[model samples]
Target: MNSEEGRSRPAWGYQALVSLPARTSTPTRELGRRALFALGLLVITVGLVYFDRGAYQDNNADHVVSLVDAIYYATVTITTTGYGDITPVATHARIINAILITPMRILFLVLLVGTTLEVLANEGRRVFRDARWRKRMRNHIVVVGYGTKGRAAVKTLEKNNCNPAQVVIIDGRPSAISDANIGGYAAIEGDATRRDILRRAEISKAREVIITLDRDDSAILVTLTVRQLNPSAHVVVAVREQDNATLIRQSGADAVVTSSDAVGRLLGLSAVSPNLGTVIEDLLSSGDGLEVSERQVTADEVGKSPGEVMGERVVAVVRNKTLRRFYDPTVARLETGDQLVVVRRSDQAAAPLPSGGERREFGGRRGR
Candidate 1:
């Protein structure tokens, strides 16, 4: 294989180290409860045999029933695997066997077999639900890696009116999957870099994919796999190293966020001027001081300059999927399909732009 091909394939050692969460055979509480109940039943059956020792006899080797013999007899009876080695000689012993022992045996069977049946039933239901979900999934977002970045991205999407049901989380860690489940998101417990796992998540039909894997190589592999599976899906990835951003984008990611670089820049800004950093942070945060939002240009605002728009402070305009700054010559006249990326106070509601192409007072306080 060529050097590029070797670099693209996942390493065998890395795959071995990736700990995919195991499929649950049964819920923890249900398994514990059933085990305790079975133990209790065994103890009760043994106790019955001990209290009625004199009434029973062992048919093998001419020995009288002792504690050990009673335990053995109870085990055999509850399991319904009677060996014909123990017999009740007295009438009361037979009566006890009919009324008490039989019920305990039934209870033991229910406790043991019922748990297995429940596990099987749950597996069946999960399979059916997964199949149905995959069939109906479209325009859905697949979030690979439920780490801090992934969680924050999903939260932002949810805040913007995205449905939780439409977001699917994929993570290799059991804890991450548990967290996703607790947050009411459907999750797949497996490595996102694997083609089979992405296929299971129905990446081909996904509308968008957000990759937040810790390692740059894993993120790049996932981006390549997702792009191959769905050529049209918009892939956004987070990279820890700025050097890897270009490589990730080349692997077919639509957008690359260099987290480390951004954080470093913010820290530098804060060191130089604290107020400037604070203002930028406020704009980045949602429902805090100031919020950044993107909305389509209103019909009345078409053919008007960004400076003439009211309500929000238009910082940039997105036309034909390309960003143009407010002062850019291209954005001097807003078009019908243009989108405005603006900043406003968290408490303010956006109002329709006036039809006369006249400027109005910005409703939001510009900065803290």
Candidate 2:
């Protein structure tokens, strides 16, 4: 194929249709035909009324009004609203009446009824569909924002079988709403930082909420709103600045995603272990394969060791300011409130680390 043909090949499906060239006949002829047809219909109705007026004789005149009055009556009656103020005195006048008026009246009523019923039927179907969708959704991840980071988070949720239907996105931008399929997914248009919008998306009912907006302030606001609306909900807020991660966590986010920290680690890994970096990227960015998970060691997991509970291996641990590696069974003992980051395949199921152990002040650890 030539270069032009090769360039055109990529355009197909809905995208191709939208990119196709517009034809002059498409809009021009359609509008012209409609305008002409409406004018013709109006002229015919007026002519028929004039013909009917001439037929009314002196016998009709005794109780009759003017021709204008008869035309007004015809207009009102055709609208399916007979005021009953004027009556046709003669049998011939009512019998051999305007050819268009009766059928036009019937058509008008039919159109009115049809439009009304269609709207009601459509609204009913929407309600039923939304109810079904909401029912099938449980513990589904809800993501706020659809920027670069937010889109990445969505892919992660889907890769982990989070259920596409259960995923609800709350973003203020209309363009973001239009980008994805959005057919089965529920997306609300509003500022995620606003409490009303969060409530509208049923944040309290959401299993998890991830805020990945570009602005740190926006993310912080969203984290605060979600915490107040849903204290139990697992909230993950993204922070571009490394220093802001702790602030985000303090603002009620269960966890903070630091892009700087992540990219820095990734670059370091790529230098020492290129193959490992590739594997990690594929797992995080793709829809299948391995996934990253982080869970805080609660008071419940204090006494248990990592090997005893976590099926996956710990990648790293953040204890105080030091980075520690998972050594063996002895080091596996997790204190209460230690953050553990682990990597596991998507299909593999895992139980939470053991619960109910002695609390300690080893700071915290970030496990891979």
lDDT of 2 by residue, 220-281 (tens): 88898888888898888889998888889899987787898888888889899987677756
Instruction: TM-score each candidate.
Output: 0.73, 0.60
lDDT of 2: 0.66
As for model 1, its CA RMSD to the true structure in angstroms is 14.1
lDDT of each: 0.85, 0.66
Clashes of each: 0, 12
State which candidate has the highest TM-score: 1
TM-score, prediction 1: 0.73
